[model samples]
Target chain A: MAPQPKHLSGDKAAINEFLDQFDVFLLDCDGVLWSGDNLFPGTVETLELLRSKGKQVVFVTNNSTKSRADYQKKLTSMGIPSSVDEIFASAYSSAIYISRILKVPPPRNKVYVLGESGIETELKSEGIEFIGGTDPSYRRDITPEDYKGIADGSLLDDNVGIVLAGLDFHVNYLKLSHAYHYLARGAKFLATNTDSTLPSNHTFFPGAGSISIPLINMTGQQPTALGKPSQAMMDSIEGKFQFDRKRTCMVGDRLDTDIRFGIEGKLGGTLAVLTGVSKKEEWDAEGAPVIPAFYVEKLSDLMG
Target chain B: MAPQPKHLSGDKAAINEFLDQFDVFLLDCDGVLWSGDNLFPGTVETLELLRSKGKQVVFVTNNSTKSRADYQKKLTSMGIPSSVDEIFASAYSSAIYISRILKVPPPRNKVYVLGESGIETELKSEGIEFIGGTDPSYRRDITPEDYKGIADGSLLDDNVGIVLAGLDFHVNYLKLSHAYHYLARGAKFLATNTDSTLPSNHTFFPGAGSISIPLINMTGQQPTALGKPSQAMMDSIEGKFQFDRKRTCMVGDRLDTDIRFGIEGKLGGTLAVLTGVSKKEEWDAEGAPVIPAFYVEKLSDLMG
Candidate 1:
């Protein structure tokens, strides 16, 4: 069995010692800072404390539907101090990875976007050309003539070398069919994240990972995911922030994605807040996949 | 090492013995009788020969995009002389299984379809009430207000208790989102078939199974697939046709679906036709998943 996490709220000394250990702090948003549109109490004060203590705070979110700028606006609206650079949305991670890392060759260097405007916006900022997402022509119901054209290779763009998938509100069989043809013809497959479901309006809907499942089935391939729990996202963060791995702490509300992401990324430690999805009973259960280094009833406990 | 399949085309005596052993012949359409829109030279002659020998011919197909009536019309146009009763489409299998076997009861019995009109046609024929499939109101892009409505449980129908998925050409994010909501609200899930890619226009496209994948990911549940290679499909065929399992010979080009379907269903034997997907090289390979009882270079070779 995994070692039990230390209860931080019970000891003020433990909280101070924990705060002093990390120069940089990585935080997950949705379940930690707030639930849906409502912000958690002391969210601003907690971040202010971290900043006053000379700690670097970066908001790392797996939601690919929002670009970094978009996230910054949401954070601002929620009264959280944030900058575009400090926000590492999965959409931005995918864009930077595609541009600075994957680097598909020129002439056939475009990506076929099977996602939302967030991906397109990030890709455009990275100067990575893309097609297909939110395009009116590709959004319509596919006709028999389109089928014939697809079979003959006339309906598809030859320049699409990478198929980047994220959560898409307008996802249709037309987009899926086009993605299938591109993948079948040997294009690389990538996803911003593979989170199964998205939390919205105090409930959950299908996530970006759900979007890739059908393509994965059709192509017999799982796309390289650039989200929480994937080392690629961690590498990008490390590369950009230049943080000391041994002194940087990761904090979140979910055990599977956020805590696991911190542990698998080999950060100094992971802190779990109980105000969200996981509870103490989950880690205490038999054969837990991940256990946090410390736990608190909520994020505001660090204010002590 | 596995034993090699018996080659039926090389010897006339072997073909006769093979044909005499079975009272019924189960055929897969696309690869066996024809490839795309072109019918093989001896397809009609082979069917006529089998009927003259007092054998029952049943067309078993995993394609759910077309109903039995639609299949009969295509067969009639191609001079295949197939009757509606002789066809056991996956769509028809799902309708019968849902209406007769599963029998979801009371006011919450209507199905929400995430497939094409073929499934709608079959379910309608079976007198099962359904919604969502090909519904013009349900085919558009989802909005923020719609998300709120879905989360608050006003947009979704309370009568929907089952979500059936198959190949849908017009499948969109709206349909997937609605299905996810229904499924999350305790609705049973069913699928016509889970074939990964649909073979069409002499090429390949995303199959019915692809449509079910996203929902499976979101729900973390695999639906009961009422199609080829599943026992439920075999049971339905057996219940309707009333044929002895040991006297039925299954014939198709694909080893994974057709041959495995027959073998797993405990049919007398399975014949491999090399015109569609699988070849002798596949079954002859070490640690092969499936091997046919006999091999033919093409379906028409049995006419000898």
Candidate 2:
């Protein structure tokens, strides 16, 4: 049998002991810090307390909808201090993986991107030229005849060696056609994340995973997912931050993505807070794939 | 341990004996008689030959893009005799299945459709009312704000009890959002077919399955697929033309959809042609899931 997830109480000694084990804290954004721009009680104080203790903090979000700069601005706007360097979103991670890891050289590294401006921003920041994302030409509604014309190479762009897909609001048939073309022609396929749903002000919208599933099904090839729960994102983070795995703790609200991220990344430990999606029943369930290292009702409980 | 697919040559005696085994012939369209608008050589003659031998011929296609009337016109335009009655497309089959089998009576039977005009036409022909599909309102480009508004009930349709998705050239976030709303509200989910890619003119385009996958992933609920290889399609066919299974032969170009349809339907036999997607290597591979009963280089070979 494996070790069970330890429950952490509000006792000051216990909380201090828990904090003493880690020198760095990695946090999931949507559920832990805030829920769709609504900050949970004591979130700011908890972060400040960690900072006061001289612990390193990083925001790891699977939100491909926003670039690292965008996330930094949002955090600043929310009265939380953040820097672009401290944010590790899937979009940036994917761009880094494609540029640094894949070694896709310039001029021939034109990617057919199926995502929003966030992905475009990251790729552009990395000096990666791409097409088809957020372009009005590819955003138009397509007909069956348009698809035929696309299939015949009438609108195909040459030298597209990579196809990267993320959460895109302007997803259209033309974009799908281009992605399918590059994928069929042996272009490298990458996705920011496979988060099925994006939680907003109490409900959920289709996430990047939902957007990529169609292309995956069409090409019969799984993409190199660069997000939480995938070891690739860990490699990207490790390459950039050089954090000590023995002193890093991941704090998240979801078991599948966040806790799994910590587990797969070989982090020191994972802390699950109940201010988000998972419940006590789910955490106590048998044969859970992602039980955390510790559980707390809220991250603010540590302030006690 | 099982029987192998017999190779058919142009032996007149053997051809006649083979033809004698089936009184009905079901054909897949895209790769069988035609590839896009250009018909295969001797396709008309082959159909005529089947008809002359007193066989009932039905065109079964997973192409949800066109209505039965549209297919009839296309067939007549191509000089192949066909009627709307002889066509059992997934669009029509799905419409019939929803209206009749599901028995979603009027007033509450309004469907939130995520497809093209073909699905709308079929649903209307079946006396079923629908919204969202080809609605023009849902065809516009949406932003994250639009998705948020849709998630918050600003754009939700009232009493949409069924969400039927098929191949829609105008697929967008708005349509998917509405479908998600209905599904989350306990509406029945239905898909015409889950054919991954639509092959046309030697290239593949995204199919209805590609369109429906996102919604399927978002809801975590599998839609009832009404198309080839599914027994529901067989039930729909039986409800219309009461043909003898022992005397029916399914002819198709693909193994997964066409041959599997015959095998799952328990038809007399299946004939696979080499003019389409499946190759000889795949057919001869060990543990192939859908091995046909016979193989021919071309259906035109039998017309000889």
Candidate 3:
């Protein structure tokens, strides 16, 4: 059954009571914090208020385009104080899952990445040596005749142990061929997230799921996704912060990712904010897979 | 139930009787005709003999990398005289399905091709205008920052009515982004073939399916595949040759594509030759989805 979310009024007493129930808050970035480059009103004040009340705030984002430090910088630039420790981006989570959880070391444990420099940065920071990511060799497009050499496996690295895929703008057959060869030969498959589309400038475009799908189809293997609403990301947060799952609430705009992330992780509660993907009709609609435990006009509704 | 194939010995009378039953022959190129660059022994002779016996032979191949003319030339150079009319490649079938069958014409019917020059060539031959395939603009790999312009739909052609994908050597993010945009905007998604891997020089590499999977995943839509084992190609053949289905026989080395193609099309008969991917054990495996109506050690085994 879908979670029945209590529609909280803009009543200050009720909002304070609701906020009192959770010691920690897991927040989604794109929709709740800001839409594209524009920040929503009361976002910083709400975060500051939560922190002043001793409530821990963890930023959980499925955007694999940026590293944790990059997100921290972006958040700080937006007048919201965010440190790397409080940020849990999918790219960093993927790196942590691969290096720490999977224990994939350098050299033989080399990863073939099909993503941006964010993934590269995280992997490098974790001391996980990888190839095919942001590499100039794979950037050039070739004709059908040129594929003969690639298909011959002459140019592929022999030591790809894991294939980590994310939101790649340069996804080409060269990287795909190498990933296919490795996966077919029993290499581990990993993905930062499987978000079908990403919201940018109030429009949705193909997300990391687009990059990972081809690999999934070719290899006939599903990847171990390291982003919301995957359990791995929640586990990563739990491992690092030691936050009590029962006292932590997830707040976001998307039902499938944020609310589902909280539900799948068995968190304290999930709050759906309006200012993003899901609408009131959708929440009111019957048979939704992931209904939030609470509904508010926006994340900053508590600020009033 | 799997079709029970009658195993034929090298008996001349039985072979001749089996051959006489079918007025038309549909042959798979890769395995039945040749393995990579080397033709199986007696393949050319078998085709010649079939022609001499007044049996019509149609080359049906799932390999979308080469155009019909290319295949015809390859066959001619290899001592097998094949006309372009007798060749039904997946590339040609995709073009036919998009242009003639689907009736997507020029201007607003512009197709975004995600394959090699073969698909481009076939589409061009059919007077179907397309973009992205073999285009120098789409072949360059870019960083995540580069995707911003692509994702914003600045680089995409607005008149894309169909996104046709096949075996692409230059499969890259730029093409995928455009395809994704088009598909998300309700463009028809079509695939030349959904074969996962292509065999080349004793090695297997990522095939057309690898290129299409990302689109499939991103759009949550399965493409209408125009290749072997699909009724679309058979329909195309029927439209062209008016061959009697009951009097037609499919000869292939693989049970999945060749035999299944015949089964799906309900052709006169399906013959499995053991000169390619499937072994005798596989053909004889219990509960196989696609068992040929007849089996031979090789096409040459019936040539005595």
In the order shown, what is each candidate's alpha-carbon RMSD? 1.4, 1.8, 2.5
Candidate 2 vs candidate 3: the TM-score winner is 2
Compose the digit string of candidate 3's lDDT tens values, residues A213-294.
Answer: 8778766799999999899988888878999999999999988888899988999888899998888787678886678889
Top candidate on lDDT is 1
DockQ of all predictions against the true structure, Cα-based: 0.78, 0.68, 0.54
Q: Candidate 1, residues A1-304: lDDT per residue as tens digits?
A: 6789989996899999999889999999998999998999999999999999999999999989888988899999999988888999999999989888888899788999988888888999999999988778887877898789888899888998999999988887778888888898889999999988898888888899878888998888989999998888998888789899889989999999999999998899999999899988999999988999989999999998
What is candidate 2's TM-score against the reference?
Answer: 0.96
Worst 10 residues of 3 chain A by lDDT: A141-150
Model 1 scores a TM of 0.98
TM-score for all predictions? 0.98, 0.96, 0.94
**Two-way TM-score contest, 1 vs 2, winner:** 1
| Sliding window of 10 residues with minimal summed lDDT for model 1 chain B | B1-10
Deviation of model 1 at B220, angstroms: 1.2
User: What CAPRI class is candidate 2?
Assistant: medium
lDDT per residue for candidate 3 within B1-304, as digits (tens), equals 4656788857788788889899999988888888888978888787888899999999998889889998888888877888899999999998888766899655679988888788888999988888888878766655555466666767667788899889988776667767888898888988999998878756777788888877887777999999988898888888889999999999998888888899889998989988899877875688877778888888877676
Clash list (residue pairs), candidate 1: none
**lDDT by residue for model 2 (B1-304), tens:** 5568888867777678889999999999878888778889999988989999899999998888789998888888877889889999999999889877998865677898888888889999988888988877787866677766677777676668899989988888767777887899888999999988887657888889988899888888999999898889988988899999989999999998899999899999999999888897787888777789988899998975
Give the lowest summed-lDDT range of ten residues in model 2 chain A.
A141-150
Docking quality tier of model 1 = medium
